[model samples]
Target chain A: MTAREEILSRIRGALGDTPSRPDVPRTHRQQGVHRPGTPELVRQLIDRLEDYRATVVRVAAEDDDAIGQAIADALTVRGIGQVVAPPGVPRAWTGRLADVVVDEASIDARTLDRIPAVVTGSVVAIAETGTIVLDGATVCGRRAITLVPDTHVCVVRAMHVVQTVPEGLQRVDPRRALTFVSGPSATSDIELDRVEGVHGPRTLIVVVAG
Target chain B: MSTFLGMPGVPVRGPAADTAVGHLTGDRPFPAAARDSLADTQLRRNLAHATSTIRAKRAAVVTEVPDWEALRDAGSAIKADTMARLPELLEQLEANVVARGGTVHWARDAAEANRIVTDLVRATGADEVVKVKSMATQEIGLNEALEAVGVTAHETDLAELIVQLGHDRPSHILVPAIHRGRAEIREIFALEMPGVDPSLTDEPAVLAAAARTHLRQVFLRARVAVSGANFGVAETGTLTVVESEGNGRMCLTLPETLITVMGIEKVVPSWRDLEVFLQLLPRSSTGERMNPYTSTWTGVTPGDGPQEFHLVLLDNGRTRALADDLGRTALHCIRCSACLNVCPVYERTGGHAYGSTYPGPIGAILTPLLTGLTGGDDPNDSLPYASTLCGACYDVCPVKINIPEILVQLRAEHTEAHADRHRLPTAEAAAMKAVAWSMADPARFARAGRAAALARHGIRRGKPLLPLPPPLNGWTASRDAPRPSAESFRDWWARTRGPSS
Candidate 1:
């Protein structure tokens, strides 16, 4: 047998027979926000996120032209010129921003090195914690898009927001890659001083599209 | 064969072995030298600032949820249940992992765990391995083990890299380099990083970029990776790792052979159990609504991730810890580090003063329990006295470990076991003994209180006279002696106002 098999056999032997079942329920109590709907949840999530020092914006959900224009306007206001987007990102979101270079997913790291911001969608949003969960799924793009860029603009639809962490975990299947971001990547390691945007995105901008 | 050239010497026993002996002899305690550490004002200020900020943030976010209490309870219960049935769940976990094409290795202690990981790396013919921030590895001293075998363990986490470069021990659980500021980090980077820019500043971005540049090469080059899990789900046979840095993702994916060393107690009964912990861990630890990076992998996929996966399930002293009914609840710790943030003693002395990977209130109770204070050096006996019995650790504990109660209990045990060797002559203990003897008769009890009042005139203007001394010096060392009143409160009250007046 292979090393994996041998290791497994040892584990099996060490563990022995299965024990009696616990009386407690396996699933946690669902304590999600009782939002009237997805839009309210998204707005609430945005408000809570903003409280954490995250920059938030509101945009149209279906108007790719407006979405692109808004992103371009935001980037221009921030004095950024280049942006990176995953391959599956809707072209409509980029159509209006001609001056902003839209680096494609297949672009090499050298080219991506020039980009200042990346816009994508989130897999889920947790209202209770004001957190956004993203995988390399639609909108949220690949993990690198959110990680490598200096600024991350994650778009969350009102419909995708959940009430609590448990609800969020249920929506995320472990088989696929997942990244759960609360605020921007931060550290307090330095003399217990909080310094934001250390290794991941220095700034996380949430675009809550209703 | 080339890997053996720069190797460090491997002791016959691993770090766990030393700890086990320490545990067995009941000898490893806080040393007298550590007493001075509690007076470090700079460390106190740093810890005060760090812990307060995280505590406030945690309280704010935690209160946002209506059922957060329920979640905390559930999380504690799940962990308790898992630990109670650890032997069986471990077997189930192994079977499920094997069925899913994953491998599991059982380590009786740290030495066994380290050997398994080192041998696994050797089998893969990898000279170097990238590492994620794993407390288990630190607990078992895996890096030292790997080094002895000529395997270079490169820490991928930014803070961990700083610790590795500085040759310093981790000072905080969540932030290993918490004791270091940006200036210190920059200095370490300049001195240790190969081809690092000379103009590096203490600016956050500059330091992070330097670290990124340094690690990017290692990430691209390493063929083997090792990690520890935050949570191990038995039902799904999965391991979960959470971090703010993307390095964990890089290390988890980039390596060809992945080895994870997890404490056996890390297991939860099922994936669904994640709900309660997912809520409790992030907020309690970093004061974030959610962790920035959470990665979960169950076995191997054909072409997607590491082709060979090995999970070393380590017991170390967990079973021994489990046998003690009152102490076993410690296993419920998700390592969220909430208790450390609120512990007054820890805030002043910092993590290094504990002399163990586990520190603060949790370490105070845990280290002695795991090591079982039977024999060994003076430090082990001293650990029980390390606490101020402030009860702050219990309040902030997400799992509600009742740290102060446990500390007192351990102190009693320490005193009882080592009664003849080092007897404490505490004034309060002597007073209590007298009171206990008098309390057997109501007449003697009444006379004792009256006599105590008559002796009150001897009390000095400001300084109170404590009846006994020496071992009680631990308390009086820093505090002003509380003066006894001119008359006992009970007698004064009775003389001034009749019982039913």
Candidate 2:
């Protein structure tokens, strides 16, 4: 047999049809483990993120339009005009920001350099820890968009947010690339001084959608 | 290009006689140096600020989960059990990996590990290999080994690439280029990157773009990829790499041949064991609940990724480290980097001061065990005295490796190794002999204490002693000597209260 086949056989042998098993189907079983509620998890996640020195803002699900407006306002406050969005980002979200030019899909390094903020949707949010999980889907583009922009505005649907890390890990598909962002990219390497946005985004802004 | 199997052996040096010969005396004590380091204002400020922020961040997220402590306990237990059953687990892992069409090679030390990897690359006829920031490869100096054989090793991790291009050593465990600022990175890119934009500024984006352009070519072209595992699951023989950058995915998937060189300490008993480490590692090292990317693969995946796979299980003195009852806990390190984050000495002197790929608290313990103190004036010997035994490393270690305890143990070993060279003189020995004689008897101790009190009265009021004579000079160099009381506490109590009436 091939190496791959042999590896599978060994894994099966090692597992040995153990009697104890999880309740849910194996694929779905990983994602839906015990987690905190959306609102509570979001609050805890934001609090922890702030401890990491990440800038956080809370918005209600009813204020989905306001989430977009907040991104535009943050950009204006930072004195930047251009914003980048992933291809699948809701048009309603970007349509609300009139003053800022919303650039979508074709956001390469050169283009991202011109953009001041990137607002995207999250794959999942772990409320227990206040971490935003991004797969290469919807508002979260390839890892580059969130990393390249100075400020990242991640919109989390309340329903998608989970309470714990284990629950969050289960939901994420291992085959596809995923990025778990807790706060802005930071380092304390130089004389042990905490510096933000060294290689990744210097500022991380979380928009919690109800 | 020549393979590692056919290359000449490179001698390794220990830390003692390498750079610290002048500072240390025959006493084998770091009392003076340790005291002086405490007074360094800049270092204190830097460490206090850095550690506090990460501490606060880690605590906030960690406390969010009710199971956080349980996870940490589980992670520690799993690593302990794995270390205990390493021989059997490794054999099982090797058999499983081999069955999956992947090759398994056992390397005894850095030289052998290097030779195996270099030979594999040569056999593949690949001149360049794209690497995903594997510390094991760095520890073994695989890039330099590959370079000697005319094969180039390209580091795809942005921080590692910066470290490589700058000709600098990694200063931080997670962020290797933490010592360098953007301005310095811009300068390196300008000087080193072949097609770097001439007008590139020191802006983070500009620097990142330059690196992206430079490495993109290598990622697409390189046929061989080398990596190190965060954990190796024994049950399924699966290897996991947890990273923030997506570059690891590219390197793992795009390359035709994937070779992973993992230290024996990385094994976990089962996939369930990963649950504990996955929770502990990210929170401790990067201050995240979970990392951005965690990739796990077993053997090979038909047409999806690398066609050929190899796992090189590296011992390189790990077994020797495990043999020591007090020191075996050092092997339990997950390389989460929490100890490095909190170490006061590492924060100031930086990673280069340790002079090994493994730096900071883990380095202090592991380097000496791996390289030993016997080799020709080796630099690894001084690593034991590099810490102040502050116990900060022990507090943050997820596996609860008693770093301070191991440091003391290593210090004792170092003294024994150089006992003849560091022997006390006849006069000093005789003085100590007299003191020991007096200290052993309670009546003599009381008499000495009374004499000390009498001596205190004669000490000049305005002028305090700055330097003590000979043996005590080390203590006086960095701190003030406390004034002795004019009367002993016992005598004062006796006089004030009339014999306990």
Candidate 3:
């Protein structure tokens, strides 16, 4: 018999039709927030992001000009001279940037690393965990866009912000690549001490638009 | 060699193949191994400091969550549910992964799993492959197998890199090289890694930078990457890797072909079910509200990341572990090492003392069950006795595995199986029987006490005689045994409360 058949038979032999799941009591907090843009919960999200040393920028949901201004300001403040995006990100968000290079999935991994920062729009955001999810949408670019660069600036709209991971999962396209960033690239492997900037982008900036 | 149906890998077993199992198999019983580990003050200091830091961090975060216990219960429940329905869930997972343009392989044991992976890397014809830190790969000794075939595997995780560079075994689950300090780390990098800066200090940032610079060229050029999945979601066939450094992301996304070796127990029912683990694991393992990065992919995504993906479902000793109803709950382990951090024995002796791929409370129960210590000559038989049964492991276990209860059960199993193995009645068993008989009756107990006192008369200054005799020598080997009191407590009470008084 094939290994799969033998293994499946073994599992069947081990647990012979004994019902064991009905007694699993699951009374845990499933959703910390069901609504989006609650001031207190957003503040909580900001608190978590800052705790992990990721910068957060708040903006009005529909104000493209303000979103543009926020992105430019973040890049300038960090001295990120060259930025890369997928070109599907609203031109308004890249307003007046001197060295913004927008290309959609055409850049090679080698040259992609030369850029100082990456700006993209997120598919969903989780407030409870302070996470931003990229579903490889046109605006989100490919997986390599946010990864190879040293800085990642993701724009999350209020409607896309969810209270729990489950709610956030509901919005993402499961077939596409999903990168969940809670903070900048970090590691605690060295003596279990938290040290940032290992391989992926060292700095993460989340622009939360309400 | 046929490529029609599923990847039907081979099965490996028996004592002859023990060496094929690599570090997962140990030669010495836990006691002897622990003696060596305990002798190293450096190891003791490292284990004490690292375990204490993680323990405090875990407690602080777990205490902050109002539903920590509830989450733990739900986590355990979810795992149990997954296991009960594992056969069906695994089938579903296989189907989903295949549908997403990924190949799925079934490994019956360690040797077969190594064979499948080695062949896959060979097919790619890449002489070198970068790897994400994976216990499944380590357990099977995949790197050594690859090396024998002239393929080099580079460990990319910072801790794993430290272990590989130093030619040492992993000492902790989370921090594999926790036994090494900053100074040792610097020395390893300076001696091992080519092009490392001469001025590199023991500072973590400087160390991290040195690694980043060193691994960048390799990550960019590598065509094949090997990994282990934290969770295989049956709902979407998505494999998720939760990691801090970008090494995991680099391996998963940069390579042309990606292969993941996952234990059958790592599967969950659905995407929604992922929330519980995502929340429970970070807080319980790393003591973070959320990990720095979590990368999830369903399979091939046309022009992005690895175009060819393969999922190898491993069942090395899992089916055997699943056979026992009382001991099977151990399969629910998430490999978080929370039990190890909080275990007093593990904190003192470190992971090497356990003498297995897994260590501490989990390894104590797990290694024996996996290896099947039904009788004599099993190195893992002594592991069940390594713990103090403090229940700290169970308390901190995210999935609520009752480790203490299982440890006691295994001890009983070991004793009963080996009871008649000897031709002569051993002094230890004989002494136990005598003690039991004496304690069963009041008069007999008094007589036994008198006998003990008479024997104690041979002692000098309340200490047992040097070079003590059989069975008694085991105790005296560690410390001098105190002589018995002249009058038993029972006798003293009887005389004082007698009717004549």
Candidate 4:
């Protein structure tokens, strides 16, 4: 028999003639107290993002121009001169920034590594866990665009914010390569002391637009 | 890999016994190994500090979730349900993965797994590969196997990189270099790492930045990456890797070909099961609300991440563990390392004493269950006796594995396996027989108890513990022997109430 067949046979034999199929209880809290995009949920999202030491700037106006201005301001504040923005990102979001490199198929990881920061729109954000899900959609770009840069400035609209991890999972497409980022890359490896800013992004600035 | 010739119920011994070999065995028994580690004051202090900090962080986050107990119950039940249907789920996983343009290979043991991975890297023509932190690869000795074939594997995670550069073994599951202080890490980096800044300070942030600078070029240039899965969803063939550092992202993305070796037990039945594990894992490990990065991929995605994906489903002793009725739940572990943080014995002796890729309460039972006790002088047999049966591990276990109960069961198996091999009863058996024979008769029990009272003289004055003679000295060497009372309870009861009631 092939290794596959042998492994399967072993599993079948180990399980015995009658395998006990225990019923799984899904009674853990599936839905939060408030709905996905409510004021309370957005506040919780900001709180969680801040807990991870991420910078959360709430754009009062949901228009493209206001979001663009906020992104520009964040970049200027951090002194990041150049950014790799994906092709599908709203032009208005980075219109004010001096140097915005539109992400494309031709850009390799080395090119992305030279860029100072990446600005992209997320698929969904979980309020409870402070996670931002980025599918390899047009707006979110390929996985390397956000990964190779020193900083990530994600734009999360209020409607994309969910209350819990279950809600976040429901919103994501399983077939697409997905990256769920909670905060800036961190490690507690040294003496178990949590020091943020590892290989991913030294700085994560989230712009939560209403 | 050597093929198994034994029948289904026949014990898997001989060649099959060595199949699961890697970092799973200790050269010495647990007591002997623990004796040396216990003397290292630095190791003890580091362990005490790290475990206590993680325990506090875990407790704080666990308390925030009102339905924590319910979540644990759900996690435990789902794993049980998955184990019951492993063969079917694995088939489903393979089909889904193939449908999505990914190839899945099944390995009966570690040697086959190492061979498959080495071949894949060779096919890529990359002499070096970047690696994510994976316990599976460590267990299989993948790095050494690759090095034998002239391929260098660069460990990208901060803790793993430290272990690699220092030429040291990982002591903790999450923080592999938990035994080393920041000063030691700085020294290693300055000495071993090429192009490292000479004035590197011992501060963690400064050290992490140095690692980022060191590995950035390697991550971009790598053609192949190897990883281990945190969970594999059988319904969609999606493999999940939960990590705090972005090195996981770099490895999962930048490489042209990605090879993941996952233990067969890591497969969950459905995608929705991740809702429970993702919630439980980050909190249980690193004591964070959520880890900084969690990457999930389903087979091969066009124009994003690695286009060629290979999944190696490993069954190194998992089937042996699954065959046992009560011992199978050790497979339910999500690799959270929560039990290690809460274990008292682990805090004292550290992970080196356990002598496996896995350690603490989980390793004590898991090592023995995966590799069955081999009668005479097997080191795996010592693992089950390494625990104090405190049940702290069970309490903190996210999947609620009864580690203490399994430890007791393994202890019984050890005794039985040895008894079958030897003609004469062992010392422990003889001692138990004497007690049972004396207790069976009331008059004889009294005589024996009165004679045992004479042992009180063995205690040195003012010293709490009584050191015993050679036969029982090994037991008392680690454990304290309390002084025997001058009079037995049975003798006192007889003298005080003779013919009264």
How accurate locally is residue B52 in candidate 2, as Cα lDDT from 0 to 100? Answer: 64
DockQ of structure 4 = 0.65
Judged by DockQ cut-offs, the docking class of candidate 3 is medium
Best by DockQ: 4
Provide the lDDT at B1 for model 3: 28
lDDT of 1 by residue, B394-413 (tens): 77677778788878888887
On lDDT, who's better, 2 or 4?
4
Which portions of model 4 show Cα errors greater than 4 Å? Answer: B1-21, B457-467, B478-480
Q: What CA RMSD would candidate 2 show?
A: 9.5
> Estimated TM-score per prediction?
0.81, 0.71, 0.94, 0.96
Candidate 2, DockQ score (0 to 1): 0.09
* Residue-by-residue lDDT tens digits, candidate 2, B1-501: 211221122212211111121111112222333444356665455456555677677777666555555565666666666755665677778776777678888765577788899999999999999999888888777888899998999987777888889987776677787666666778888999888887799776567667766776676577899999888777777778887655676677667899999987788777666656777888888776665456677787554457799998776656556556556678788887888877877776656567666778988897777666652245666789889899999887877888999999997787667654555533445677789998999779778878888766444552344445766565555555566788877678778987645
> B416-466 in candidate 4: lDDT tens per residue?
888899887678988999999999998898889888888777665533354
Model 2 lDDT per residue over A1-210, tens place: 432233223322322233122221112123334444445566676777786677776666536577777666666677766667777777766765644444454333555555677878888777655577777665566655665566777787777778666677667754344566766655343333444554456677776667
How good is model 3 by TM-score? 0.94
- Model 4 compared with the native: what TM-score? 0.96
Q: Which candidate model has the greater lDDT, 1 or 4?
A: 4
Per-prediction share of native contacts kept: 0.31, 0.08, 0.63, 0.75
Local accuracy of candidate 4 as per-residue lDDT tens digits, A1-210: 899988887777677767778999999988888887888889999999999989999997678999999999999988988999999999999999889999877899888888999999999999998999999998999999999998899999998888988889999988889999999999999999999999999899999999
Alpha-carbon deviation at A139 in model 4, angstroms:
1.5
TM-score of chain B of each: 0.87, 0.86, 0.92, 0.95
